[model samples]
Target: MPEVARVVPLPHEVDPQPQRAEVTALLEGGLIRVRLPDGREWDAAWLQAGGSTSIELAAHDWVIVLPPAGGHPAVVMGRIGPSARPPRRHACASRRPRC
Candidate 1:
C-alpha cells in the first residue's frame, strides 16, 4: 500500500485569518491603510458601504479586516461597533483615570 503525502506549509508562509486593525489613513476612493495588531501596516479596501448610504470611516477607527487571498485584495469588513478610542489619561478635578 502506498502512503499519501500530507500537505504542509513552510515556516515562512502565513495562513490567512481575520484581524483587528486600526485605520491609519483614508486614501482616494474607498481605499485606506490600516495597522494590524502586530504593528504591520497594510493597504485595504473599504467594502462595507454602498452607493445609497455611505459609512463614514476615519483615521484612528478600529475595523475588522480580511487579509488578501487568492489574488483578492485585502478588505475591511466593518468597524468594531462604535469606534473606540484608545484609553487616555487625563488631568481632571474628578481624578478619574480616563476622564
Candidate 2:
C-alpha cells in the first residue's frame, strides 16, 4: 500500500487578543528582541507548534506577543498584515485525526 501524507492546517487568523509588538532585534537561541507598544523591550521566545511547524521572524517584523505564563518569557504568537515581504507559513497542531 502507498503511504498517505497528512496535511495540517495553519492558523487562519492571528490571535484576537494578543499584545502587539515590534521585533527590535534578533537574538540567539531561538529568541527575538521585541518592543511593546509602551516602549518596553524584552527578549521573547517563539512559541513552538505542537508538531514540526515553525514560524520564521525577522527584524522589524510586526508580531503578536502573548503574555508569559508562570515565570516564562513572552511568546510570539503570530504576525500581522501589511508586511512588505512575503509572510512566512506556519502550522498549528490539531487533536483530530487526519481525514
Candidate 3:
C-alpha cells in the first residue's frame, strides 16, 4: 500500500506590528541598513533563531523595523511577506507505526 502523509495543524499567525523600512544595504554579521519612511536611516540586525542563524536581506526589500527596548539595538523583524509559511511538522506527526 502507498504511504499516506499525515496532516499537521498549523499554528495561528500573529500580526506583525512595527514601522516599515526599505533595505538599503546588507552588511556583515547579519546586519542591514534601512531607510524609514520619514527618511531616517539606521543600521539594524536581522533576527535569527541561533548563533549560526543568518537571513539574507536584499536592497529595496520591505522589512518591519522594531525599535530598541531594554537596551537592545533596533531589530529588523523580517521581510514583509505576502503570506507566512506554516510551521514545520512535529516528529511524531510523521510516525505511522505509532498511530
Best by lDDT: 1
All candidates' lDDT scores? 0.74, 0.70, 0.72
Best by TM-score: 1
Cα displacement (angstroms), candidate 1, residue 9, comes to 19
Q: Write the per-residue lDDT of candidate 3 for residues 3-66, one digit (tens) a residue.
A: 4544333234533347999999888765688899999887886666443244556799999887
Which is the winner by TM-score between candidate 2 and candidate 3?
A: 2
- The residue pairs in collision within model 3 are none
As for candidate 2, its clashing pairs are none
lDDT of 2 by residue, 1-99 (tens): 943544433344534356899998888786778998899887787765553254567788898887554445677877676635756555553455679
TM-score of 3: 0.55
Clashes of each: 0, 0, 0
Residue pairs in steric clash, candidate 1?
A: none
In model 2, what is the error at residue 40, expressed in angstroms? 0.8
Please give me the total number of clashing residue pairs in predicted model 2. 0
lDDT of 1 at 90: 58
